[model samples]
Target: MYGRGGWARRIERRLAWSDSFVIVVVMVGAHAARFGWDPLAAVAGPSATPYWQVSVSVAVLWALQLGWARSREPRVLGHGPKEFQRVLIASWRTFAIVAIVGFLTQWQISRGYLLFALPLGAVVLVVYRAAWRKLIHAQRDRGDLLAQVLVAGPARTSEQMIRRLQRNRRAGYNVIGACVPGGSRARKTPLLEGVRVAGSLEDTAEVAMSLGAEYVLLSGSDAMSLREARQLGWELEGTGIGLIVAPALVDVAGPRVSMTPVEGLPLIHVEAPQFTGSQRVAKEIFDRASALAFLFVGGIPMLVIAAAIRLSSPGPALFRQVRVGRDHQLFTMYKFRSMYVDAEERLALLAGQSDGNGVLFKMHDDPRVTRIGRVLRRFSLDELPQLLNVLKGDMSMVGPRPPLPREVEQWDERVSRRQLVKPGVTGLWQVSGRSDLSWDEAVRLDLYYTENWSLASDAVIVLRTLGAIFFGRGAY
Candidate 1:
């Protein structure tokens, strides 16, 4: 566990075994449902084998495809969406191969069986991966399964890296120490809070060994050159310590970036974001369909809430305000009136006590908030009326935060890009830190989501919204 790979190998082995077990179960289950108690049941074509044999073959191939696709690799195992993305890719390719083989050999595969096995296997595999991820997170939270690291870079970069890793401990990186970039010119004293400055960059590997660190992270900044990086790699060749470069490029989605090795120099290229395409169309269709179903379920509750609000406060039950939508278009955003009718009139008087991200107005306990309004805001029931906005094509189920024009007027280049996609009732901002996020961080999150929008990510944000609401962190 203290070796270069740390606890990753153990987790990988467990994943491999469990993946095989679940794949086999889904395959056999599909076959049994389609052709029960029929190991010798003839298939549709002359070249086709028995249904049981075909199921076995497909199961083996599917499991192999998953491994071949490297879906269970250590880097992707415990964090982010890459693990789930690769699972889908592997499943799709496996079924595609089966389809091609059936077409070529006239082996009539059962459409129902394929449909059942594919989705079932995919769901099971993804859920299993998610379960493992949760276990990894729990283990890390318990101070186990953590990969100790020695960061090598300038003081500022090392501190930033350490803080980020420490903040998101679910990623499993534990920075034990750090080394500065310059040789003797750099000070060895601890400059960072709670992190010791071990030595210079040239002695990074030695420091890593002395500290028993499993990984060495090199911050790719101006302090390190190509020769220095290569030399460091050579020094750590036999040391059992993994070297990783944290490139200055940050916060963009992984799918938009690619690395190419051109004559031993890794050139990173970022692809342009595609805002209009089939995916956008799919997002729209999904939004409206899901909105309709949600409205069906929440219709009565919304009426009840409206009645409650009307009884509690002498104001209209619904609040309508103008907000910026995709491409900077204007739209009327609706929400349950969670404040008194005179709330806006009292805004200027409370400006000095604003608890928001500066650009927007927010207060945890404002005098204008009705008793029920506070509860509604806490659970985010106040945003329920935006489903009508989604149905009216003015909003989405998940996208950038619906910004008031007052906020948009203060936009920078990054913040302006936030409106490239339609605003949402709940967004990365809602799931991330809500009103507690700084203005810059909030804009950055919105910009990232707008540029890297995906149906899968949208769904992820929506699911996370449930937890965000439940925890009620930074909600106000």
Candidate 2:
């Protein structure tokens, strides 16, 4: 019922207000800390510009930089890394400009003030943006604050797009209708379960208008020619409807894509994925060092867990299993035993009752789990010992899930891509849905991570894993 432009404007206004508030807080706090309550008097500086004047100027400049940077634009709003990156760039540019001006004009700005304010303001702005994004995600989850879209493409492509949009609700797209190659005759056969067939490609604009669509998404298989696509764009020019062409590339991040115009045609160039470099070496060192630090920090609790497991079950406190690591190498992965001594013996009887994906056996309430073991598994205490595996260089702090030897043995060419990176104590699969995910979904996420691994993304997954563990959402 809400207009897309109106919703976007509302979010933009809120962001603007929050940005101004953060800027004011950072500037005023820095001023007060450096120069105390006196506004008229300048601290020991060559220039005698009033502290209040300087604060006001800095705040206004910061807000202007944010606006000029298009940080609040709808395209980068709600989700993706672009929003944060823009905010950071804007903040750094503002500071750099101020530094240059101060240097040239011989205006003595307090070094302590600049140092304290710049980093504090940037961090506060990013935090505020993240909080706002969380609120937007919650609204989108409830089917609010989403852009209505009409999918125009072949039946297969439309269906795939709908499924993908459904999977990522935070992307803020609500598919309202579909316009395939066929006309109304194809309406009898729905493209997606809820998405209605509006009309053919020729009637896309009309269909989008009727459905109040903000955007028309053209999938890869859409039969519209270049001229026809251009005509469609022209028709929607005055209607405030945007056209988007969905490329065939899957699991490609924006950073790896570039657009170049050649002979009046926009050509998309995708960079090949890189796994080995200085970054990989740094990641390897980081994984082992962090693991060593965690082991030292959690040593006492691990010992207590081991003692509890030994007392609860007859088997050894620690459980060692063969797992496939990077390059298909085999390694002994350790975990605090969270199952009874006879758990393996009883697996055959419960195999048919597995409540997990076909490839991974899991149960919400398994009889093999001891009382103490259940507590340990619930909070992921069982995974604490994997820090040792990470320290031993056989695993990482974040990567694809460490697969059992049996699972690796059954891997096809597609699933084998996970072996390109070292197994991890936590990963996209762990934070996403864990035991609740289907085999294909799990594999898809793992491959996505494997293909587009970055230190920033790894840090994000590690943080989300903590939240998932605390909430105990999809854990067995």
Among all candidates shown, the one with the greatest TM-score: 2
Question: How well does candidate 1 score on lDDT at residue 411?
Answer: 77
On lDDT, the leading prediction is: 2
Model 1 pairs in collision? none
- Can you tell me which runs of candidate 2 are displaced by over 4 Å? 1-5, 31-44, 48-52, 105-115, 292-317, 372-376
Per residue, candidate 1 scores C-alpha lDDT tens digits across 237-320 of 887889899978777774688899999998888888888989989999999999999999999999999999999979799999
Q: Name model 1 segments beyond 4 Å from true.
A: 1-6, 36-42, 183-188, 272-286, 289-316, 339-381, 409-414, 454-456, 459-476
Candidate 2 Cα RMSD after full superposition onto the native fold (Å): 2.9
Evaluate all candidate structures by whole-model CA lDDT and list the values in order.
Answer: 0.84, 0.86
